[model samples]
Target: MKCTEVNRLLNPYIDGELDLQNVLAVEAHLQECPRCNAAIAGIQTMRTAISRACEPAKAPLRLREAVQAQFAGTAAPRQATSLSLGVCLAAAPGIAALLIVGWLALAQPWNAQSNAGTAQGTRIVYHLAGGNHVKANLRTLKNHLDAEPNLQVVVVAHSDGINFLLQGAKDTEGQPYIGALRELRARGVEFRVCTNTLTRQQIDTRAVVPEAVLVPSGIAEISRLQKREGYTYLRL
Candidate 1:
């Protein structure tokens, strides 16, 4: 990996946010480059200094209660080790955005209460296996939904197409698609991402926007939706 790339990813690496491939690449590069190794050490030292300098504070009771309430409906509530209410307060904006996105994704297909109504409709499964024409495809889907209110649309993304639904992902102009996704979602469109692709590509499921649910296999999902559910298939 280039020095520039290594430098850019150092923080994410330290934060335990890098995917498997990146972790390996960064470790390999750190072994060969003394400069980067020194940089990593310096960053660690700085973090340690800040941690020691700051006074420890207890988490607010209200915040803890709110978090508990939010995950109360989940089949298996997610837990974070070493994550405190203070860390959540420190990154509230970013954390709130991710939480909202996660709520949107998890609420759709996973929540039986919500799915009870959404699951029954004229279904159409859209296959997305490539990144090309993402915007155009989304636009088309939106237009189709506008024409048919009772139609249920599900977008299954895999391979290169998965990047479109990744968190903070942008188009050529550096514009986020979450707004558009939210709009479509409000109109009853669903988005599902493939776990197989994520595993093969060494990507963390959290890296994807919360607007998309994670499916076991994109191709298998498409097939099931078409056959068992009588969903019409469209590839883009």
Candidate 2:
């Protein structure tokens, strides 16, 4: 092997990482090669000097004094090696940890109690399955609106319930119910009509209730509100 190639193996030999065969090959080159031998000796000397200089720290009197002062609530006298803001950030992981813990401690209860009762009030969903019992549910919804006045109500009309909300439809007085529904909506009661039933009955979107927004499916929409968004469901 050339001197350059022989010199390359000297450090790995000191560290003892090479295989026995490669070590013998390098040794064989080194025995006859004076130039490679001197290079290996120089490397060994440098390695010894580096290893000796890099030693474990011995705490000095000044270091002990600073540590004692910090524990005793006295100021740590600033030094040239005083922690930079970046070092403070890296060294003091507990500071950020404490802040996160504090934020969670303060935030949990307030957020947990948010759905207890709204200042404006709760939202009630009137689930109506139409046919003969439609009248009873309509009256129940009307009665609640008359009683509370402030509570927000949503009438999710699907199937046969759409007939009662049509223009000139009576609310037990031969008076048109559409105007009353519109007026209730103005007072914060919303009417959400099921578009799926409309399609089943061959009724156009323009046919029933101007205030109603057509949802894809009545059951799916009700389930979404009740499960996902925390709205209370009442079957009328």
Candidate 3:
């Protein structure tokens, strides 16, 4: 199978839900592809970290009682019935949809943890995926740098977030945003624009400002910074 096809099957493969044919295909692809193997490892690592971080806690007695009372008046089903094969098949799509949503929600790069006591000296990755908060996030980033001159900051921009990093982009005051970007760059802040976004949006790499570096994928870069480089994640 192709890498793209393998990618779509990864979660189900990991969950042991793939059919025998698909499972064999994905396994064959994985054996020859280091990138996909790395992706699987990353997913497993994030799952482990989230599991450890989100240990279940007992609900307070009052809250539990209140929840129970709210459901007390609900009538139980009159009969317990076994689901037919056709009904189960029909619900499979819905179950798959929920699985995809749940995986997306939980499979964040920031959920993974690096080794403890590594003393990485406060590295941070700021993620920007929308245009709405570009100016506000820039101000906040500047304030952070001003407050902590020693901070190691990296800004990863994708989607409409790449607007501020484009050539001749303007701020709310009609001033060139590149000037502010240059100032931040001078202050040791690294800006990364996603090439995937550029390709998808049909934008030339030359359109990106000199102050920003183009990365293959913004989300992948964020994941690398958080997992491999031990950078804290801040989404804005």
Per-candidate Cα lDDT values, in order, are 0.71, 0.59, 0.71
Q: List, residue by residue over 1-236, the lDDT tens digit for candidate 1.
A: 99899999999999999999999999999989999999999999999999999979987764454344334344432433121223322434434454343333333334443332354655666777777556766776776676667778899999988998998888778888898899998888899999999999999999988888999988777766644565545555
Misplaced by over 4 Å in model 1 are: 1-121
lDDT string, candidate 2, 136-184, tens digits? 4455556666766666777777787666655446755456667657666
Name the candidate that leads on lDDT: 1
TM-score of each: 0.49, 0.46, 0.51
Assess candidate 3 and give its TM-score to the true structure: 0.51
Which prediction has the highest TM-score against the true structure? 3
Each prediction's total of clashing residue pairs, residues at least 3 apart in sequence or on different chains, is 0, 0, 0
Candidate 1 versus truth, CA RMSD in Å, comes to 19.9
**What is the C-alpha lDDT profile of model 3 across 1-236, one tens digit per residue?**
88898999999999899999999999999989999999999999999999999999998664554334323322333332121122222434434343232223222322333332135445767777777545656776777777666778899999988999999999877887877788899999999999999999999999999889999988778766655565555555
TM-score of model 1 relative to the true fold? 0.49
Residue 203 CA error for candidate 2 (Å)? 0.7
